[model samples]
Structures are given as structure tokens and as C-alpha cells.
Target chain A: MTVGIVGYGAFVPRRRIKLEEIAKVWGADAPAYKRGLQLFEKSVPGADEDTVTMSVEAARNALARSGGVDPADIGALYIGSESHPYAVKPSGTIVAEAIGAVPALHVADLEFACKAGTESLFIAQALVKAGEVKYAVGIGADTSQGAPGDALEYSAAAGAAAFIFGADEDLILAEIVDTYSWTTDTPDFWRREYMHYPRHGSRFTGEPAYFRHSMNSARGMMDKAGLEPGDFAYAIFHQPNGKFPMRVGKKLGFTNEQLETGWLSPWLGNTYSGASPIGLTAVLDIASPGDLILLTSFGSGAGSDSFVIRVTGRISEVQDLAPKTREQLDENKIYLEYGAYAKLRGKIRMAE
Target chain B: MFSPARAWREYPQRYRLEAAKCTECSKILYPPRLVCPACGGRTFTPEILPREGKVVTFTVIRVPPAGFTEQTPLPLALVELANGVRLMVQIGDVENPETLEIGMPVRLEFRRISWDGEAGVIFYGHKAVRAGS
Candidate 1:
């Protein structure tokens, strides 16, 4: 059974806060941060936008391109996010109900920091391959939080990407060639139960966590598939920043041309769980038939999920069915200043 | 704050935009009324209202009730859908309330309507964003 993406879609909030805008508030050097992280602006969720809401919209877009797959027939759905709106409640139930996938659906909310979205994708495709469900939806979304005046604030952003998996050859746009996951208990970044924002180990978040896991995952996946980095038409690594994906791709023998299509962290910021998944959506927007795409996503608790996808002829037909990821990233963007951004992100304290 | 029962009862309308169309008169009723007022029809079929529409009329609410203070000057509009169904909904992603005009085209998007608090139920519904945006 060939389980792959039957439909795919992505959603990014219209509002953006530029790095300079955030830097001006804290009196930090904008040029330095920009040059260092290779990030300029990040998507800001509206007052009404959250992990669950974004997931719903992304899922709706996925269903739109699903070739009329009845929402009721979706047997399972999973949403992966670090910033699920509720601590105890499941975001999947709300998403399932909204998309008309209820009663006969198996749904769960997954969290593993940034790679959570890929986690959803991994599980969703596996179930389809196992003949457990005819179709399954995997979504990665987040309105991530960063502490005030922290470096993470500049890149912690909002966005979502959703993929519907099925074994139906007629519907599969990108057939899954192989999948691999590399995980270890590395506490590079974390937030306590009651903490409002996450904490990182500065440079430690690099070498040992992101780069190590991502590199290992990509290498292991290529080795297992007996395919080199040069064999892939496009390669997407977890883009915590614009610099990391490019650097890691080069380290793994992938050219900039192969990595550029999915390198979205520069302008879109790091959407945690949505980071690489959204990048994959961007690549799928313009991918050619038989294009081989390698997607590797990394999370801070330390894990990476890599997928080898072979695009089908159906890619072109469905590419125009929904909004493209690049268009959403570049066009009709509503930029916000520091004050408005603060208010919308709930950084400002309200009167009781 | 909306009770769980009240919110759950309206899920059909809020979440899916489910409406009832009169079998006899072909009139659409949002909130899916049991009886069609136009023809006094007792039977109706389930229908989904179109997501795209034009603003028939709108108002900017400066002093909103609780649960809406964050979105001060909230722009609410009565939009007439392409299928001729009219409904009132909040205008989302509007940076300036002054930009809202009569007949401005819009598309409804799922959004968080309201919530009880940090730990309470978060209500989800559709809000109108400028079409093509």
C-alpha cells in the first residue's frame, strides 16, 4: 500500500511584525539580529487566531484540494502544536468537528516541540499504510510564545500546514517513498508546566540539538533509502532560522538550489511545529511530476522526522486549487508595529 | 460566558455554517429555524451558506461587552452571501475600521470567537476577512 499526501494546504496569519519593530521596543540592534538569525519579519496571529483556529483553516484548505474526499470519511485526524490553546482539552476534537470528521474518527493532539507537526504526518501516513483508515489528516500549527526581550521573540511566529494521507493512487499527489525518525532525550529547550515562555541553552540549542538530530535524521533516511542528497530534487530541513536549514543542507551535501524552495524561515519566522511542514507545502506548490523531495523536521526536545516524497502528475493539477504558500508569505501582508503586536500577542497586561 | 449546552447547540451554525433551506419556498434560514417563516413550511433541508459575500452594512463597536475588549473598535458587518443569504459576523484582519465599506467583498474564515478564560471553553466561529487577502 502506498500511503502519501492525498491533499495538502497551508495557512499563515496575515499580520507580520518586522524585526526592526521588535528591536526598536527593546533597543536591540536590528541589523545584528537580522544578519545573525537571517530573519526579518514573523507572522503574528490575530486576536482571534490560535493553534486550534489556524489548524481548522489549514485543514479546510487541505479538504478543498482533497478531490472531494468527504470530510465524514476521514477516519483519523491529528493536530501537532506546542501552543495548543488549552492545556487539558484536545484541539483535535474541535478540528474534527469543524471539518465534519466526527463520531467515527480517531483524533489526538500531539506535542514534541517543533517536530510535532511532522509527528502528526508520520503517524497519519502510517495508519493509512496499515489499512486502518481510508484517509487521515495531519496538521502542524502554532502561535508560539517567546519571552519578552529574548532572541526567540524575533522568530517565534504563527502558521500551519496540513496533509491528508491516503493509499488511493488516484488521489495521492506525492507518494511516500520512505520515512525515518531519529530521537533522543536532549533537553536543548523547554518550558515548565506553568511557564508562559520557553527557555533555551543559547548555543547548546545548536550543535548538540538541532544540527545533530537534523543531520543524523537526513543521513540515516538517505542511507536507508540508498539515495544520496544529490538524488533529491528538493531538500527541506527544520528551519528554526534562515541560516540553520541552509547550513545543515550544505553540510549534508545538498546545494542551495535544492534547499531554497523550502527555506521559509527568513521572512516567515520559525513557527515551531509549522516550520518545516509549511516549507514542504511551499515546495509542493511548484513541484514537477516525479520530483523527489526530502523533508526533515527537527524539534527541540530533540527529534527529527524525515520523509522521502516522490511527486506525481497530480501535483500540477492541484497546485492551483488553493492559495500557494509563497503568496501568503509575500502578498497582502498586514505589518504591525510594536504596540499593536504586543496587544495582539497578549504581552500587555489588561486591567482586571 | 456561554454555557457548554448553548455553545454546543449552535455548533452546526457556528462551525459549519449549516443553514436550513425551505423545501417549498427555497428560502434560506441561518441558525436553521425549525419552521420556514416565508411559506410557513414545516419541512426544510440542511444547507451550507456560502463563505464569500459582500458587506451589506457594518458598524464599528468601540465599547464592546466583556470577552471582546481586546478587539476594540470591533467591526461587525451584515454580509449578503452570493446565494442571497444574509448574516451578521465580525470583520477579521481589519487594521483600520474606516476601510470597511458597504458592498466590500469578503470571505468568511474560521476563527476563535470568544473564550471563558484561560481555562474555559474557546468558542470558534467564522469571521469575515477582505476577499483576496
Candidate 2:
């Protein structure tokens, strides 16, 4: 039973808002945001884009990279997002139906803040490993919200990543070596039941929230897999900002070259649940056979899900079957000003 | 709030573009019905519409509908697919709506149609994007 990723895909909205555009509005210096946060711009979802729509697109791409897997064969579908468009309905149902993975499927929407995406992946992988399903799709996506003028405004962004897992050895592009999770009761960030925006506990989101959970989960997974930081060809962490992932990687003895390819926060900003999943997609786009990749995701409620994956020869056969992650992130970008950004995001009130 | 039944009923056309093709006359019916309008044929084969198409005509909506005010000057177009199936869809990813012309090649992209309200059901459907963009 060699259950692992068969195909994967990513979706990044073309619209971008420079840190300077956001900084100028709140009277904060643009240079400070760029230098301190290590962020230049963030992707913005268009008026037509949301967690659900982005998830559908990413899932379609994943199916394309799947080397002709029938959508009808997907036994389970899950989507994780902090910014699901509908507060009540299931995003998984819409995504599954749109991608033609309906009728016979188990579907649900999961939320654990940023780690929500990988959490779905964790579940889907387990289901395949347990032989409960032949194939499962997991997606992490968000049109994440930040208060009008908070530090989060600089990083909260939109994107999605989808991964399909199966046990067929012939189609496996990577093999799941092992997985581990570290969780605890930490209130580093919260949003009221009906609040439009989330509030963070400032410095608390750092050491006690993201760092504590992420580091432990990564180390735990490594120890369980009997591997070390130096053994992996690529290591990616949940990027709340450009700084945290690099810092955590360094503290864990991972090198800059190991994290560089997946370091997209500087350009794409923190896509919440899509953060680590999208980073893993970037790494997969370039990784070769025999490559070992470690992925760790952190959520504000404070938990991390870490996985050790070993790339297989099938990677090269399907790597170019769909659009590459870098191609989506780099091409056809449309820069937006603060006013358009505000309007696009529905931060402006207009008569109904 | 829109009824889930309303959304559910349209799932076939909205999700997979499932249509009815007349087995005898070869006429394709979008939103497949019990009887074909062209040839009065009752028997039909299930067909999925081609995703690539060309804009037939278009309009720029400066004053939008209730939920569309955020994207004012929205470009909506009637697109004709390769198989001669035509449908009205919102044109996206264009920097300027006024520059749009008939016969502009387009590819179908699934996106959110509109929000019912602040906390309402989000309608998802197909929109048109400039091919290769």
C-alpha cells in the first residue's frame, strides 16, 4: 500500500497589491514593511475569486496533472480554508461537483486556520493508506481577511493548492515516508463568531504559537521517520510572513538553498491554509527523483502537521502535464492600487 | 436566501456543461430538456460542451446588479463555442472592458457568480477569460 501524492496543482490570483500601496494608506513607511516583513507584494483575489472558486481551479489543474485519472474515481474530497465564501455551506461539495468528482464521494469542509489545508491532506493520505478509498483530493485555499489597518493587512492574501493521493504505485509521484502532528491549546489568534476580520495576539503568534508548534512538529516527524534536516533535499514551513519560515528552517539546521525554492511569501504573501501547501507545490515543480521533501504547516489555533515525502521517478513524467506553479505566480500579473484593492475585496460599502 | 434546490437543479449545466444532443438530427441543446427544440427529437445523448469559445457580442455594465457593484464596469459577453453552442458569460482578466470586440477568443473559467448576501450562499459558475492569459 504505497499511498502518496499522484498529482498536485496550485492557483494564484493575478492581482497584486504592493506593500507600499498598503503602507501609504495607514501612514506607515513602505520601506519599513518591506524590510521588516520581507514582503514586497501580496496576491489579491478578483471580484469573481474566492476560496471555493480558487479551490476548483486548483483541483482541475491537479486532475490534469494526474495523467488521466477519472474524476469519478475520487472517493473523497476535502477543502480547508479560513475564508470560505459561505459561512454555512460546505465548500467541498461545490469544488467536488465543479471538478466532476461527485455522486459517489465523501465531502466536507475543514477549518484549522492556516493548517486547515494540510489537515485535509493528512486525512486523505490516511484514508488511502487505510484502503478506505482508492483516491482522495485535498485542497487548501483562502481569500484571507485582515482588519483594515493591522499588521495582517500586509500579508493576508488569496491562493489555493490541491493534491490528489492514491495507492497505485504506477501513478505515485512521491511516497509518503511518514507524518506527525504537534497540537496544544494556544489562543494566539481569534475571530468572533460573526466578525469579518480576525485579530492576532501580536508577538504571541510568533514564539508561542507558530514557532512552538511548527518546530516541534517538524522535529517530531523527522525523528519518527528517522531522518534529519540535512537528509532532505527540500524543506518548507508554513509561511506566516517571509521571516518566520526562514527563521524556523535555520533554527532546525536547514540551509537557505533548501528553503529558497519554496520561499514564496515575499511575493505571494501568506495565503493562510494555502501557504505551506502552495510552497510544497513549488518544490514539487522542480524536485527530481530520489529527492526528499519535508513540509510543515502551522495554524493560529496553534498546531502543526508535518510530513516526510520522497519524490519518485514518476515526477518527471507528470511535472509538465499542467501549468507550473512558478508560471502562475510569475506571468500575467495585474498590479492594483489601494482603492481598487479595497473595492475588489469588498472593503468598500456600496448601496445594495 | 436562494433555495438549495434552485442551485441543485442547475448543477448539471453549471458544473459539467452537460447538454442533450439529438441522436437523430445532431442538434445540441444546452440546459438539456425533455424535447429538442430544433428537431422535436425526444431521444438525446448526454454531451459536455466545448470549453473554448469566441466572444460573439459584449457589453460593459458600469452600473452593476445588487451584488456586482464591487466590480463595476463588468464586461459581460455572449460566447459561441466551437460546436456552435452560445451562452452569456462574464468576461474576466481584462484590464479595459471597452476594448473588447466580437470574436475574441476565450476559454471558460469557473468562478463565483455572486454572493447572495453577506452571509449567503455563493453561486459558482463559468466565466470567460482571454485565451492564454
Candidate 3:
């Protein structure tokens, strides 16, 4: 029983704020942010959009690409996010209901910083492999928050990616060759319950956090699957900033071309949990049959979830069933100034 | 601060766009009513509204209601669906509200409407975005 991706989709908000806009508001040099972080701009959600809404739209696109699979057949659903709208309610339930996958599915909200999204994917895949569920959906989405004047403010953005998994042969878009997760209790970033923004350990988030975990996970997964970096056609890693993924991909022996198609952080900014999954969606939109792709995601705390996937022949049939990821990123953009962005993000105080 | 009542009552309307369609005269009614004004028919079928439509008319609200000030100058429109049912919804994804025309095609998109004060239930609903965008 080989379980694989039946369908996949992504949603990126149309509103953008250039790094210069955010930097000017804070009296910082815009070129520094652009050069250092490799981020030019970031997406901003409207007054009417958030993690839940973005997830719903992405899931609808996923369903559209699923070759008309019945939503009722989805026995499980999970949403991973750092910003779960409500701290108590399950976003998974809202997404499942909106996608017409409700009344008979297991649902939950997961939080593990950025890697929580891939965690849901690993679990849903296990359930399918065990024959516990005929199909399952996993979503990574965030309208991520960054404190004003903080380094995070430049890259934190909004987006979502959804993937549906099943064993049905007719619907398989990519086969999951293997998955590996490396985790440890290394606290590089955290936010208290009442705090509006998270505090990072600065340089600590670099070495021991993202680099160690991601490198170990990628190496471990490749060794476990008896494959190397050259064996894969493409490689995607968690992109917290535009620079980290490229640097890490090089250290892993993957060429620039292998990482190029999925490196969207420079253009779209880091989407936190949505980062790597959205990158994979971009690759899937163009990957050929029999192409092997490696994906690894990192979250502060810290951990990395790595997967070796083989694109199937059916990919071309459904890749265009929904809007392409690049099309959404490139077309019809509405750029906002810093003031409007702050107001839309609720950074400005409102009267009671 | 979350109100279970508000969430429960509007579930069908917000989530599934459930409306009422009079079978006698084939008139589509939103906010599902028991009686159809056209034929005085009490018999109606549960209809789910189409997600795409054409803008019939619109207004730009420069002064938004409280809790909606961030969205000032918002574009609201009356949309006529293919089913011949017309409904009012907010327009989004536009850079300039003034560029909107009466017959511009649009599609429904689910989004966060507002929250109950600072710490309460966040309401979610549909808004219109330009088609193919």
C-alpha cells in the first residue's frame, strides 16, 4: 500500500508591501534588508483574510485538482500554523467543513513553529499507510506576525499550501518514497501566551537551530533511503529567510539549479509554516514524471521533516486543474504602503 | 467573548451559501425565506448560491463602520448571479475602487469579516475578488 499525494494547492495573498516601505517606516536602510535577507517584498493579507480563510481557499484548489475525489472520503484533516486565529478552537475543523470534508473526519490544530505543517503531512501519510483512512488533508498556513521594527517584520508574510494524500492509483500525483524527522529541544525562538510577538535567540536561530536540524534531517533521510543529493532532480528546504535555504542547499551538495525553482522566499518572503510546502507546490506544478524531489522543513525549537518524493505520470493531468502557484504570485498585485499595512494587520490600535 | 449563538445561526448562510429558491416561479431568494414574494408560494427548495457573478451596482464607503475603519473606502456591490439571484457583497483584490465598472465579473472568496472586540469570536464570510485574479 504505497500512499502518495493525490492533489496539491497553494494560496498567496495579492497585496504586497515592498521592503523599502517597511524599512522606511522604521528608519532602517532598505537595501540592507534586501541584500542581507534576500527579500524584496512580502504579501499582506486584507482586512478580511487570515490563516483560516487562506487555508480554505487553498484546500478548495486542492480539491479541484483531486480528479473529482469525493470530499466525504477524506477521513482526516489537520492544519498547522503559528497563528491559529483562535488559541482554543481547531482550525482543522473550520477548513474541513469549508472544503465539505466534515462530519466524519479526524481534525486538529497543530503548532510546532514552522515545521508543524510537515508534521501534519507525516501523520496523515502514516494513517493512509496503515489503512486507517482512505484519504487525508494537511495544510500549512499563516498570517504570521512580526513585531514592529523587528527583523522578523521584513519577512513574515501570509500564504497557505494544502496537500491531499491517498492510496488510489488513479489519483496519485507523486509517490512518497520515504520521510524522516529529526527533532530536539533546542529553543531558538518562542512567544509567551499573552505576548503579541515572538522573541528569537538571534544568532542562536542560525547554527544549532535551523542549520543543525535541517542538515541532519536531510542527511539522515538520504542515508535511510540509500540516495544522495545528486540522485534527486530538485531539493526544497525550509526558508525562514531567502538566504538560509540557498546556503543550506549548497552545504548539502545540491546544485543551484536543483534549488532554484522552489526558492520563492526572495520574491514572496518567508511564509513561516507555509514556506516549504508552498515551495513544493511550485515545483509540482512543473516537475516531470519519474522526477525525484527532496523536501525538508525546519521550525524553531527545533526540528526538520524531510521527505523523498517521486513525481508520477498523472501530475501533468491535474497540475493545471487549479491556478498555478507562480501565476498567483506574478499577476494582479496591489502594493500597499506601510501605514495601510499596519492598519490592515491590526498593528494600529482601534477605539472600543 | 465568543458567541456560540451568532456562530451557530449563520452557519448555513456563511459556510454553504444556503438560500431559498421558489419552485413555483423559479425565483431565487437569499437569506432563505419561507414565502416567495413573486408567487406567494410557501414551497421552496434549499438552494446553494453560485460563487461567481457580475457586478450590478456598487458604492464606495469612505467612512466605514466601527471595527471596519481599516477597510475604509471599501467597495460594496450588488451582484447578479447566473441563477438570476442578486445579492450584496463587499469587493476586494482591487487596487483602485474607482476603476470598478457595473458589469465587471467577480467571484466569491471566503475571508475574515471582523472579530468581536479585541478578544472574541472572529467572524468569517465571503467577499468578491475579480475573476481570474
- DockQ, candidate 3, comes to 0.70
Output the number of the DockQ-best candidate. Answer: 1
Candidate 3 Cα outliers beyond 4 Å, as residue runs: B1-3, B23-26
- The 10-residue segment with the lowest total lDDT in model 1 chain B: B113-122
- Rank by lDDT (best first): 1, 2, 3
lDDT of 2 at A69: 87
DockQ of 1: 0.82
Task: Name the candidate, 1 or 3, with the larger DockQ value.
Answer: 1
With a 3 Å backbone cut-off (N, CA, C), the pairs that clash in candidate 3 are none
CAPRI-style grade of the A/B interface in model 3: medium
Candidate 3's residue-wise lDDT over A231-318, tens digit each?
9999999988899999999999999999999999887888888999999999999999999999999999989999999999999999
Quote fnat for model 1: 0.82
lDDT by residue (tens digit), candidate 2, A1-352: 7889999999998899999999999999888878888999999999989998889889988988887889999999999998877778788988988888888999989999899999999999999999998899999999998999899999999999999999988999999989999999999998888888998899999999999999999999998999989999999999989999999999999999999999999999999999999999999999999999999999988899999999999999888887788888888798998999998887998765
**Model 1, which residues run further than 4 Å from truth?**
none
Tell me which of candidates 1 and 2 scores higher on lDDT: 1
Worst 10 residues of 2 chain A by lDDT: A343-352
Worst 10 residues of 1 chain A by lDDT: A57-66
